[model samples]
Target: MNESNRKRGVLSPCAACKLLRRRCAQDCVFAPYFPAEEPHKFANIHRVFGASNVSKMLQELPEHQREDAVSSMVYEANARVRDPVYGCVGAISSLQQQIDLLQTQLALAQAEVVHLRVRQNASYSSSNSHGGFYAASPSNSGSPPTTLPASSRGKAIYNMDMVFDQANMGYPIW
Candidate 1:
């Protein structure tokens, strides 16, 4: 027993040793990573990877790397338990899809803002040219304008309402 174990009176076996129904030696490989207080941590790992495999893996690794390896094993084991077939990969894929959807929505909103700005500029220019009063152009008599001027079109402005309608149709343009 080490100083800490000896000071605590009767030595408490580590989780791995307790689960395996064996004594925990002073130099137990699992003692540092799987303390007695956190039995579930080791339980999940043990359920996924057998006790012998964990011990052999820990023994093969350097002391500094053992802790990280144990942590990774515990995470993978828990993920495996939660999702038997796809595990962590499924969680990662779901998050990536959400990110892609959010990005598309953001791009669509940005395009809409640019389109509105172009329409506002066109409206202002027409009003200025016609004695500071709004005048309905002959191309859009008694109806709202649907297209920007040729100069504004060169600035990459498009019909935002049409773009949004297309997005609702299940096909999103890049």
Candidate 2:
């Protein structure tokens, strides 16, 4: 056959060329292959494709293929959301565990501090008083006893509370 008779590309009906007083050079191989029973042009292929119409095309797909596509899309989206949620929960749990551990350590240190203060007070009272339980009473030495006054004691306790509170409210290690 001559070059003019030889088809350049796959043949499909060109309606525009048909209306414009020109040959409707059929192209797009699959077009002719499509069964007449199937709907044609799917939302006027001439115009821009719309999301809603594309969705309708998906809906028209075979049941199994449509189900698989929908299920896969849903699963992928759910996985995207679920992975982050699970990670956040795990991170929060780890942070809480760290906080608990730090709180326990602070309590132990506070107890140790109290124990040391009590020991210091006992040693001073014993040394300052002549067997009297009170550090205020005068001893045979006649020197004014070294003792933490009530105001100083209150201040010390207040300082300890502030220190431990600050420690307990510390940021998570991780």
Candidate 3:
């Protein structure tokens, strides 16, 4: 056979053909994607999707899209093997739960930081003024201080209220 024919496995059967116990024709759909070296790739796919179904699927798609389709099929087949029922969905759900837990922890940490900053500012102003006794000013009483120190005024402050609100609204913060 010629070089192109040899590459197409006219001489040696492709993985799919070898697994199926059939000869690999020059026009075999599985030849390019399922080379002879990676028999396990086609084995899992065949066990999950079946050879006839895969052949039909590949034949229906354009040549340019076949490789990607095969890759997706392989991934799905592997996932299905690992998780018979939920497959990739189970992995995704676990990751999402982790994200939610981390976000909650982050929000709590941010609130604590805001609380500490307010307390520090309160103490600093008190110590500098009325003999270590906190005299709540008219602008500061009954509410948290909105104005930051002159050194911190130009920096972006984390608004814990907005973060809590967004967290309550079921949206991701980061």
Candidate 4:
């Protein structure tokens, strides 16, 4: 009768009625309909040629193809799962600070080594001039060296006979 009613075919509804401003009738799920709509060009083409179609084709394939498809999916998932997880910015920055601290310590150690080397060279230069820094080698000089045997349990041997020499030093008239 009217332009809107004439467009209403045997219970097919418009996109607007089906989706929004919900109202329904017995014949159509959503009323106030339109009919003989042309299919969306891109959506139809995608349905025929896209990944969904490819997946369907794979599903209908032989056993080896199906296994290959599943394995590829699993491999992709594993790669995503096993990827090295990066820490947050703060953690990474803290690690960098630790590295910087270690580098500074290394530099300090290197400087100390250089200082020690310089001191060693200075001592070597002064060794003959000043009789510097006694090294306890039996071949060179000095008093008898003390050595500990395995049986000596951290005790030093003192010569008590020298301490008692005063007693024997008294008058010897005989």
Candidate 5:
């Protein structure tokens, strides 16, 4: 008896064949993508999509496109195992939600930075016109005296409390 023929049946089967408990032929379509080392991968796929269906899918596709088709099927099958109800759609929806949340946070942070820069510029301008900027609070004593240096006499004097009105701000960041 030839040694090749004797040992051929004992050759280590591909992951797909092992999980399906079937003979793995020399030209098995799943040999490349579904190596025997990682049985769990094919097991997960088989659990979701039966071995017969996978074989039919592989047989239907052209030889050149079989590898990509198997990869996509495995990925989708794994995802389906993780999320039974929505499968890959659930993962896609989750990722999209996270992206939207991150974008909103980024927008709010940018708005805050712009607001701070404007406030800083205003304070710097106020100080440059006079020796320093003074803050006034509306107290029971009386309305604070509205006086300005000769250089800023015609310029409008801004009140911090009034300037921080929520409606005046471009976006409601909070």
Candidate 6:
């Protein structure tokens, strides 16, 4: 009614009226949910579900549920437009497959790390020589070959385990 809000003013026609080529009533059902700027969004919806059917469906729903129903229809319509054969299900299946692959890859990486750690620990326990993954101290490796204190040996293994856990899991184990 105001001068600024005249025909096709800042308020463009709702998508349904624009598509249907008619005046959008003051109480147009589509106005609140589908704005004029997003013509394609409603176009996709209209293409998938006919205008009359959409109107009837919206009318059947309670006021509170209409917004959610509109959103679901729009999403499904878009998905159907993208992939007519399988629609949203195709997209969901593809994402699930990718997740499954990444999980398998993570499992393999974890197992390989555990296997390497076991071998390295075995070498550390068996070797008198200093040349191993868990290196002996220079003082112990050299001529006198002094035995390490119990606490020192425990700390070395603990440190190695901590490093291994951090590398594999992105956090300290203990």
On lDDT, the leading prediction is 3
Badly placed stretches (over 4 Å) of model 1 are 1-3, 6-9, 136-174
Query: Tens-digit lDDT track for model 5 on 135-154?
Result: 43332123233434579544
Q: List the global CA lDDT of all models.
A: 0.77, 0.46, 0.78, 0.41, 0.69, 0.71
Task: Quote the RMSD, in angstroms, for model 2.
Answer: 19.2
Q: Which stretches of candidate 4 lie over 4 Å from their true place?
A: 1-87, 130-174
What's the CA error at residue 57 for candidate 3, in Å?
Answer: 0.9
Cα lDDT of candidate 1 equals 0.77
Model 3 residue 53 CA deviation in Å: 0.9
lDDT of 6 by residue, 1-174 (tens): 422463435566788989989888767788778877778878988999999899999999998999999999999999999999899999999999999879767755665675555445445564555453344444224223334556656443322332233456554342
**What C-alpha RMSD separates each model from the true structure?**
6.0, 19.2, 6.3, 26.7, 9.0, 8.7
Candidate 1 lDDT by residue in tens digits, 1-174: 444863464668888999999988877889889888889999989988899999999999999999999999998899889998887898888999999899788766776676556666666667667777667875324344343457754464554465354466364443
Q: Report the lDDT tens digits of candidate 4 across residue range 1-174.
A: 433563554444433234333443434311222222522322222233443453464557775565555444434433334342432444556789999879766655554554444444444444534465545443323433233345743333332242222234352211
**Clash count in backbone of candidate 1:** 0
Worst 10 residues of 5 by lDDT: 136-145
Candidates sorted by lDDT, best first: 3, 1, 6, 5, 2, 4
Ten contiguous residues minimizing lDDT sum, candidate 3:
138-147
C-alpha lDDT (0 to 100) for residue 154 of candidate 3: 41
State every prediction's TM-score relative to the real structure.
0.74, 0.32, 0.75, 0.27, 0.69, 0.67
The better candidate by lDDT, 1 or 6, is 1
> What is residue 22's positional error in candidate 1, in angstroms?
0.8
